[model samples]
Target: MAVYTHVSAEALEALLARYDVGELVSAKGIAEGVENSNYLVDTTRARFILTLYEKRVDAGDLPFFLALLDHLAERGNPVPRAIPDRAGVQVQTVEGRPACLIEFLPGVSLSHPTPRQAASAGRALGAMHAALRDFTPTRPNGLGVDAWRPLLNRCSGDLDQIAPDLFATISAALDDVERDWPRSLPTGTIHADLFPDNVLVRGDSVSGLIDFYFACTDIRAYDLAVTHSAWAFDATGAPVDAGVGANILGGYASAFGLSSEERAALPILARGACIRFLLTRAWDWLNTPADALVTRKDPVAYLRRLEWYRANPGCFA
Candidate 1:
């Protein structure tokens, strides 16, 4: 959710004319995330989101993402559906990039979530996994364990610039994670990047689960691990709030029970989750342009999480 490409008023009006969303009253750029260009669009009919698929997002994968949202919305998951144009086209070309007008779900993204809010988010995630159980479309996890080492290799030159001994430490962690990566587990379509901002809450309940850009076919527990790593930690990567983590697990369990095998694999899966964010953040930190309209996240944050996971393997137990 960043603004790389700027659309002029005339261009925006032309684009809006393709759909029945009415004349554009206002559109503002969203600058929170680093993946795509997003704008909070308002029109005569209603509010909506205009997302321009950025370079990092492969245009070919737009159908999978849009269809996933449709499927989840059909099953009553709190997800936004892509709005189709007058010609019944969901995907459209806007400003020379593939784009979509997304349904604007009503909710606010929480920065510092309470335990009860975390529990609601967990339940939403569990229900999402359940809804996706019968979804047959399969897209492999592009950022899975196998892709970590290569991603790390790309960031090797600038690893130590971010932190001391970061390269060697990440290399060793990758070695261990690859060596013991889970062979078999219950797999399904997962919201691989279930960070705090991706979830929208109305009071204590989840109102929307936005951002399906990173959703893919992966291990079910790994999705939980990603959510745990995201919601259970502070900005400095400290596990200061035990209540949040506990309630998240409890709420998720109440909705979707994890097998004993999945439970046993949590620690390692969490380590893998940490590595995924650490590497991607490092890459973005090193490569993103200084003038880019996006926030550059700290790679050291996830480094701290990796250290905690290593020292406290039984943290999940």
Candidate 2:
């Protein structure tokens, strides 16, 4: 979120006028995410995250995302709530981009989590699943396995530059994931992309989970799969201490228990996690501007994880 769309101070003033959040004393670009443009917005009343929905975020999906945020926050979930404007609207147009002011959540996202930290994140993930149990509306996971193939195809022709046979490797892995992918499993609100960066921690406990842009109704264990690959692996994409993975499993079991079928599907879902990040990394690697402020992560790291999962499918067992 490193200043994708530059909003001047004058533009900020106009945007602030639409909301009752006092004055815009300072606004600085937040250097956290690769999607959406975010600013650390401060007003006379309080601080907030001023987000300008980027092209990657669909305007049609705005209502769902906003409503979900409101729902989670109201349930005492540790998520940022969208601040409604003077007109009682949470979303508006600023600099011709869909924008919203979100209450600033406290705590920092952990880059390298210990086993204890992973346990806290796992409990938080389970709690999130339970808290949203009654959220009536459902949003399908657009980035689920169905969406992986086209993105893989889009990146196929250019993947040779990344590594020999990389495209074929991913294409084959996609086939495996789809073949083994569960047709019927526990489905609910899942933070499909619960990577370490999206999970915030303060002290030994989880402060909250953020970045619900990828939130959708999917297999609950799939969320754990996503988090497993995210939290149980080092930056090198190799599994961390075995205890860390077990710790996550234990924490998740505390609230929403995983069915045996869900446990069995974890391997394939974890592999899907690798595929999801790999395609995006490959696509962004080829497309991101050279001078862009964002860091383009090497796609090979996930490729390593894919290979490891293929060799040792008992990662979550």
**Residue runs of model 2 more than 4 Å from their true location after superposition:** none
Candidate 1: what lDDT?
Answer: 0.91
State in Å the error of residue 297, model 1: 0.7
> Which tens-of-lDDT digit does each residue in 1-317 have in candidate 1?
79889888888899999998889999999999889999999999999999999987899899899889999999999899999998999998889999999999999987788899999988999999889888999998999999999999888868999998899999999999999999799999999999889999999999999998999999999999999999889888988578788777878888888788998999999999999999999998898888888988888999999888899888777
Candidate 1 regions with alpha-carbon error over 4 angstroms: none
Model 2 collision count:
1
Score candidate 2 by lDDT. 0.84
**Model 2 error, position 65 (Å):** 1.0
Candidate 2 lowest-lDDT run of ten: 288-297
